[model samples]
Target: MIFSEEILKWYRENKRQLPWRDTRDPYKVWISEIILQQTRVAQGMPYYQRFVAQYPTVSDMARAREEEVLKLWQGLGYYSRARNMHATAKTVVSKLNGKFPETYEGLLKLKGIGDYTASAIASFCFDELQPVVDGNVYRLLSRYFGIDLAINSTAGIKQFKELAKKVMSTTNIRDYNQGIMEFGAIQCAPRKPYCLHCPLNKSCVALATNRIAELPVKLKKSKVKLKHFNYLVVVDANGQTILEQRKGKGIWQNLYQFPLLETKEEMAAISLGQLKDLGLGDHPSILLYNERPMVHKLSHQHLYTKFWILRTDKVVAKAIPWEKLPDFPVPVLIADFIKRFKF
Candidate 1:
């Protein structure tokens, strides 16, 4: 059976009833694509809806503050996406005169948009014959074709993308694109894929050869680097705590966090006065009360974090929006700290 036919048949019966799928609006499609990157559908859907509802147009998003955008994207991790979305919105409004670029190449020029995003926007919105190659699509194609190349490698990505484009039906690019993606997301899931019910099972090379898992190969990731962070939660008698915004191009840039001191490794000794070594301790009052250590994992880093609660009489100078900490939105990691420490 032809690849497009199998996908089309499966999509008609199993495609998700997504709002973005029902329309050809470039703006909505772009928003969905970006939010869905490194994010599950169940997780990305609410953020997509809220973003579309809050900022209907690129100009509206462009004019919004980064804090406001990040606030709306509080729970959703990979904050870089929110920042990129905000930056791209401003670019679209300013560079394209409030109009989303209409072609694949034009869309690719936008900040944060890559080949996959460009293809999705182009095919979905303009019916352009461009193919999207996300992890789902990669897995499906590799399994069906029995390709052995590492899917995450630079060369592997190029090869798979070429193969995907070759199989993409030009007659109805929009439906074809949506059909393949839907087929991958549902029928050809990464684990325990329903090979028996799959429309392409007859022609799937990986299934016939008993190499389903081995075919969709990926390069092993480097070991996660362990880093330690000591957060200071200094509170005045008014129940308000000092919060700081991370700066200078490291992880969590521009995001609000507690006063932090990063050490080479986890510190065995826990003391209030030790903060002076990290450029603290000058405050008039420093009463260390409680300490909690959390291990937060990211894709490339494992964060071993410890928070110290200290009582102070005044706010520190480096704190972010100190008077308006209540107004600023915080990530769950920070929110949990506030709830437990009680200022």
Candidate 2:
């Protein structure tokens, strides 16, 4: 199709020189695709480089500790992706004999490998005829062809996948897939796209119908629930602070944070009296109090956090030397607090 040919031509002349695109290694491609799922290219590039350097092979990642893997992925949100990626690597080594699945269906069987990721790895690494249907592809196809179905809907996803397959090049699968994604990212961007000089402007239905902003319709996101976090930065006379690893299947799982006290609403004051109520101890002095709460927003949760420094003369249990705080992996909010307070 002309659409495919034009996009491929544009990609050849204008695509970014990404490290992942330089190799046909399925492992590297898989890593890049996973990192870039909810992350921008610029943001995910360094993480991709770090993963490639730390775990040069799937066996390397399989042998590494989950804590070490989570540490490397500290600032990157969506910790589950890292955990799943680690699990998938182990599966590749133990179950698949250190080799990634060669087919789209086989790749999808691995942990965290969805249709889009499977298609990307299969086409880019194995030159398989699988079309990737990510947000970029959805936007490109919807706008260019004037498809109005919600990209998040069940029917919309199926329709887009079928259309993507139809337009995808059978022989030049890699370039065609890359071209469509890149074109959507840089050319037909969501905001203020350069439509005047677009290669497919003449054939774009959205442009012709004066509905460039309306073509790629998406369902409204659900309301983000608000939560209050009261972090007890407990410190002893020897400059030791207590940090607990987050457990359970919630946000920031497996990451370190201060002893937390979650409340339905913001606490007016976390005083010495409150410490006794919380069963931590009695008569501890409030060393540092952040009157202003820091607002940390996640995809589905809005955390209103306040850090209270509780100082005591006696040694507190589970306390680590303050200087060694950087050794552990923490969520971005905690990491930023440490950086700002020079902890």
Candidate 3:
């Protein structure tokens, strides 16, 4: 009770005035929670606001095209989250009549709603006694309890979840959960925490032991796989370009991009012979956009990409005017190119 009281006091005085705060609307909470996952508040705020304005309700989102949703979500990466959110919106509109599930278990069954998100919505909007254990919670609990377990490890996850459940306040369930997470964000930060003035400093185990830097351990990630991507930027004489949609599963599914020619390994440069069958004639001009391949890093793989600009008089069958490029959804890598590359 004392710990919870201290956290709530600090929270009431120091919590940021975010748009999603003080709202019991489940849709708003759901959207905000999803955007904040693996994204910083400052980086995600504009997108959250845009999303709320664009799709004010589940029915609005369900009626929107997936391409439109992806375009709005461009540059934020982790496109799978947007896809799942769209699918869930359609599900809610069709099956649940635009109403979100009220219980943590029920929310968990929805697409893209994991334990953290479910707990967040369940407690914040539904007044359920579910606790959230996100990165902030994990860090704060690890240091305060002086636990040195690797947070990514299975045993560590279980131990911390059990601890969170035990410590979560029952009297002020929503406020307590929100306060603890807010405390972790501002006071018990990952680096350079304000331990000297922290509300829990007197009883914090890591501070007492002088091991704040090492308490929250995390195992090293596996080596990132390397991929060689060759993109063909085909522009006809009429200042039009060709694009193809990414089909099936895997990275960037259902997104638009220039015709790609993936290779097993990186190549120095591509010649006209390489574009032999890709609607290129003998006299077409081929130039490498970058002298060296651009390294675009994703969570699992590093894309060593090279965009080959091919201009020819050959009339492409499905070429679209370059002015219409912004209408289609593209990856951040391609979006950056479009910003710099002038026709």
The C-alpha local distance difference test score for the whole of candidate 2 amounts to 0.89
Q: Write model 1 residue lDDT over 181-281, tens digit each, in one string.
A: 87888888888899987778899999999998776898998999999887777665455556767779877777888778789977666565666533344
**Cα TM-score of candidate 2:** 0.96
Number of backbone-clashing residue pairs for each candidate, in the order shown: 0, 0, 0
* lDDT by residue (tens digit), candidate 3, 96-133: 88899999999999999998999999999988998789
C-alpha-based local distance difference test score of model 3: 0.89
Score each candidate by Cα lDDT: 0.81, 0.89, 0.89
Candidate 1 yields a Cα-based lDDT of 0.81
Q: Each model's TM-score, in the order given?
A: 0.92, 0.96, 0.96
Task: Give the clashing pairs for model 2.
Answer: none
Q: Candidate 2: give its CA RMSD in angstroms.
A: 1.6
